[model samples]
Target: MELVVARIGRAHGIKGEVTVEVRTDEPEVRLAPGAVLATDPPGTGPLTIETGRVHSGRLLLRFSGVADRSAAEALRNTLLIAEVDPQETPEDPEEYYDHQLIDLDVVTRDGTEVGRITEISHLPYQDLLVVARPGGGEVLIPFVHEIVPEIDLAEQRAVIDPPPGLLEEPPGVDGADGADGAEDGRR
Candidate 1:
């Protein structure tokens, strides 16, 4: 299985060191020195990690043959993918790889069908599950234990306990009833 481990950011310095937005939890194993990663643009890599360091809380990587800032800048926004065994699982049972969550059936605590997991959005603060709703739309479900209480891999389902408005469309703001938040045509 191929998993996206990181995305190349801006060039860190004059050297071929580029900052990366780390995606995978096992960066020490996946993005360590001497690891070869495939790039999203396909032809841009199989870039080998010549060196890695943490500068200003960001991961800086220098790829083999990429010797200058321009070379590093060229890699910006490129995704770094790593190959892994399909049977590999995380050390912690509570944690799950993005690949494992994708395609899992989504249901409410009451067993109402909500959608299917299409994507996992990894933000700096939280991860969001992109679900394709049965009625032909998408909903972003925050992948928190409070909202998503259970992930049954053997059953291939995610049991969510969403708040009142979570699974539905957002209501009017400022205590109004409509989208514009106005019962009369005043404000």
Candidate 2:
């Protein structure tokens, strides 16, 4: 699987070097020279790091053959991706990549299947899982330990025990008072 590592920023100086805003917390390990990067915007092509170093808390990267300001400027906002081996060990047991969480089934403590995780939204306080129900609705479940009690990645399922009234919508709020809302426990 390919993991996003950084986004290309403005060109640094007149050379083909560009400033990269590292997305991973372990920037030092990911932004090393000779690392292969797949550039998005599709046709901009892939880049092989000729040289890479941290500068002003961001990454300064020089890609092989990209030799001028124009070349670097064209790549602004392109996402940098690295092909990650699935067998590679995770940093921690609890630490899961966003891609791994996607499509996992979500269930209740009573063995009731609630929905399947379709997407994950990163927030300042906590990550939110977007669960798509079979009945054509979505549940916004917070990724808190209190709510999501268990996750079996091998089974591709998660168990949740949401607080009371969390799934209830206030009266007269459009379609918020649906059965899926009750399952999501989003107030």
Candidate 3:
């Protein structure tokens, strides 16, 4: 299986160092030195990782043979792909890959069907499960242990204990003025 591990950002330094937006949970393992990554444009790489370092909270990588800023900048926005065994799983049992979570049915604790997970949006803070609703719409459920309590791979479902209003529409939509406690026009 091929997984997108990171995306190349602008060149960080003059000596062929490029910033990367990491996508995988295990950057040390996936983006480590000497690891060769396939590029998105399909022609730029198979870039071999010569060195890696953290600079001001961002991951910087130096690819083999890329000796200058122009060469590094040329790789900007290119996605780094890593090959993995299909049978291999994460070291942490609680952690799951994006492929494993996608297509799983999402339901509430009481078995109320919510949706099916379509995508996993990885942000700096947390991951969001993009669910495609049954009736035709989408909801972004935060993929946290508190919100998503259980993930049953055997059952092919994710049990969510959503807080009140987590699954509801936002304010001022379809006659929903969001008048929860402000019944008397108070702010």
By lDDT, the better pick of 1 and 2 is: 1
**Model 2, TM vs. native:** 0.72
Per-prediction TM-score: 0.88, 0.72, 0.90
lDDT of 1 at 143: 94
lDDT of 1 by residue, 33-120 (tens): 9999999999899999999999889999999999999999989999999998888889999989999999999999899999999999
Off by over 4 Å in 3: 173-187
Best by lDDT: 3
The lDDT for every candidate, in the order shown, is 0.92, 0.81, 0.94
Better of 2 and 3 by TM-score: 3
Error of model 3, residue 128, in angstroms: 1.6
The candidate scoring highest on TM-score is: 3
Q: Which digits, one per residue and each the tens of the lDDT, describe model 3 over residues 13-105?
A: 799999999999899999999999998999999999999999999999999999999999999999999998877889899999998999999
| Candidate 1 Cα lDDT to native | 0.92
